[model samples]
Target: MLLSDQAGQTAATKIPRPATLRESVIEAIQELIVSGQLKPGQHLVESELAELLGVSRQPVREALQQLSGEGWVDLHPGQGAFVHVPTVEEADQLLAVRALLETESARLAALHAGEDGVRRLRALCARGIAAVESDDVEAAVATNSELHAVVTALSGNQVLAELASQVARRVRWYHTPVARRRGMDSWQEHTALIDAIEAGDEDRAAQIMREHTEHTRASYMEQRGSQPVEPAPKPVRRRRPRTSPTD
Candidate 1:
């Protein structure tokens, strides 16, 4: 049955998806960033991005705004949008938060994970390890994220999982640089963590996860410390022009 709104627009059984084009463009840009195709601090040209993505400038503009809100892109007024470059402090703080949340998640996962969940984790671990072995940095990073996501899901805590999901991409951003360096060791730790969870050792699982996350945090800090920090340009706010009184 169709219903009419105050605007006299007919509402059928279905409604058009809101901001579908903008959302798709947002995902595409995020993928480019996460995969390192769009390097940090690289300028994002709206027209070029629109042409590349086969979308219009309007959607690209909207997507850049959304990405900026999410910290994936920085929009500088009068200048343009650029990919966000992670600071050492940002990486440390974010990873610290991740460790806290993931530790508890590991405890819950151990308490809640079933055999199928354990099997799935093992499969993800294998894929990550294989990616590292092949020196496929992008694949390794992606699989690493998947492995952590699965662990969070296994926790069976809806709220915790949601929070993890929110920060997962940012975490991926920081992990990209260290993927190759941390690869084998990271996956080995995943194996140990999975064993702990599979054995239902909550304490062990939490401890392992805490240590594993700390390792990544330390790696990021060390690596980023050596690199020069470039401050992101802030957007200039335009002021309204003053007018004289009319005669």
Candidate 2:
């Protein structure tokens, strides 16, 4: 009887874990992209990723599909998946859409966020600032993403929150490399935005949020080179005529 009870207890303790392989693959790939390891425009080979993660192709495929839906990866009809590299125009369009959604979310949050929501947002911002100060660009990006998510959630609109979250995830790709080079000042804009939110200044918060996202869009374009929407001009420098002393 004692032995059977002990066996039963051991069996109970050995309960099977939940299915997380697909989620793990998704997270690993996202980390690689955001940490600049995978890089923008890089191909995502399932075989290679499966080998690296010791996962089967099925889970990798599922994860890739999910990422593709999230706008993080581009799925080709027959060539397989590659990381999505937004053109300047695509970035501008995404930013414009996000600005409209997020500014309204911020406005709603300023009016509706409870004490707990405010605390969470402030904590996220603190973590983001710390990450920026320590030059941990990836962490800073993640924390900033979390801050926006919290604000959106506080709005209590499920549809808006879902849409904003998806848009923010895509925006994160552009900020990865840029954040490391830009450092804390890259996030300075958030300070005013958060301040306005905390003060319950809905209009100010909305305006600041819009401006912040627009600024990010502009910076991304500037970094890629001016006239980002247009094809780069061919290099043109006039050649100096040779000065020859003629008789």
Quick one: best lDDT, which candidate?
Answer: 1
lDDT of 2 by residue, 14-127 (tens): 677775989888988987876678866677889998998898999999999998997677777656788776677887788789889988998888888867878887788788
Residue 232 error for model 1, in Å?
A: 4.9
Candidate 1 residues lying further than 4 Å off, grouped into runs, are: 1-19, 232-247
lDDT values, one for every candidate = 0.89, 0.78
In terms of lDDT, model 1 sits at: 0.89
Name the regions of candidate 2 deviating beyond 4 angstroms: 1-24, 61-71, 74-81, 226-247
> What is the RMSD, in Å, between candidate 2 and the native fold over all Cα?
13.3
lDDT of 2 at 163: 92
Following a full C-alpha superposition, what root-mean-square deviation does model 1 have from the true structure? 5.9
User: How does each model score on TM-score?
Assistant: 0.85, 0.73
What's each prediction's clash count? 0, 0
Collision pairs in model 2: none
